[model samples]
Target: CIHDTRIIMTFLLTATFILGAVIAGVYFFIKRIYSYWCRKGVEYIEPDFFYGNIKEMVHGKISTGGLFKKFYDDLKSRGLKYGGCYTFFSPVLILVDLDLIKNILLKDFDNFINRGMYYNEKMDPLSAHLFSLEDERWKNLRAKLTPTFTSGKLKMMFPTLVACSFGLEDVLSEYSVTQDAVDIKEVCSRYATDAIGSVAFGIDCKSLKNPDSEFRQWGRQMFKEGIKGIIKA
Candidate 1:
């Protein structure tokens, strides 16, 4: 009797394991390949679970602007109109209907103000910037800061921008004659870092001119992709 009971228990455990595995596999498989069901005559592609329609997004396979364009086009071509598709069960909300986008972004702006993107205050202060804030906080902050970036203030900044451009041009001119490819992103970033430094802190950071400059090195490093994103993600 003892041997028979042990054998039954082992069989039960095996069955349970098999059932769990089957359930999990089926869910992911369905999510990845068939998350979105067509609305009436409209056809739509599905997205993976957890990652949603974010395979290309999180991977940086395409620029965000381009991805939005693609998403819009896919839905528009199929004439989805006002229906939403799944980003792994989370609605992608294809606004092929122009009226809906207009209502959400411009017309009925009060209701759809908050976006649920990640912004860890402790981890990323820059990420906690105005656009990241939500609801009343965002509205109030925007109103408060509206006057800070006025046309007059921007006009005042024009000269500073010109000066920085000249500095960059000067630096670039020395390297242009050489046939070797220049890292424009790196050079431009250096110019930007130094410009922002001068503007914000009243510091003369000649990051563009001096390769060995401590500020310049850090400036370039900031633009370079590092372990930071990996850690954060």
Candidate 2:
């Protein structure tokens, strides 16, 4: 009985020691990651341990765009032209100056090409769009697509856009008579879907009149699935 108890105690101690070491190693690793911007001599917002600077976003308290705008405002208020922040220990640099943004996006684009987005071309072809492509792939795709979005093409599409707006107006007018609170974001999304469907597919989606239209349903489903995929990633 005494030998068995000794063996059990030794096993328990060894397991505890290994667990404690792993915990300590992970904590230090995270701390090191959080210091990335600091080591580069950049001013940065202090980050929380696990969630980093996106605690509100992680908790669904704020939209991603709203949170980034808030961060921009905070940095600008402090007279910062640029600043660093963390998204789950990944360092992100935010540029406040328009000139710097222009330079990075246009003049110095080659130096800042990678967007750090995830995409699997084989598994999900839609995921490999221009926005997520990097390096040579992005450069090549942008060159090919640039002609499609020229001024003349947009001018030709203007009438289609105007027609879609009329549908939006009709929907809003009905809601106005009923004095119902409107979800403007959803309304705009439907309008956008109708416009895109008309322009791209040469079909009237009628998303404003029929929320369950095939195109609108697919759009919503795609967005829902995309968000879930991003969160899981």
For residues 1-233, what per-residue lDDT tens digits would candidate 1 score against the true structure? 99999999999999999999999998876654453444344455556565556567567676555666787887778777754455434555556787878878777877766665446768666566576678777798779877867999778777877888898888778787766688887788778877887766668788888766888776555334333442343
| Alpha-carbon local distance difference test for all models | 0.68, 0.86
Check candidate 1 and list the clashing pairs.
none
Clash pairs detected, candidate 2: none
Which segments of model 1 are wrong by more than 4 Å?
Answer: 2-45, 56-112, 211-233
Report model 2's TM-score to 2 decimal places: 0.81
Worst 10 residues of 2 by lDDT: 224-233
Instruction: Please give the clash total of every predicted structure, in order.
Output: 0, 0
- Candidate 1 TM-score, C-alpha based: 0.62
- Tell me the TM-score of each prediction against the true structure: 0.62, 0.81
* Segments of candidate 2 deviating more than 4 angstroms: 1-24, 225-230
lDDT of 1 at 18: 100
**Candidate 2 C-alpha lDDT tens digits along 15-57:** 9999999999998999899999889998988999877898887
**Candidate 2 clash total?**
0
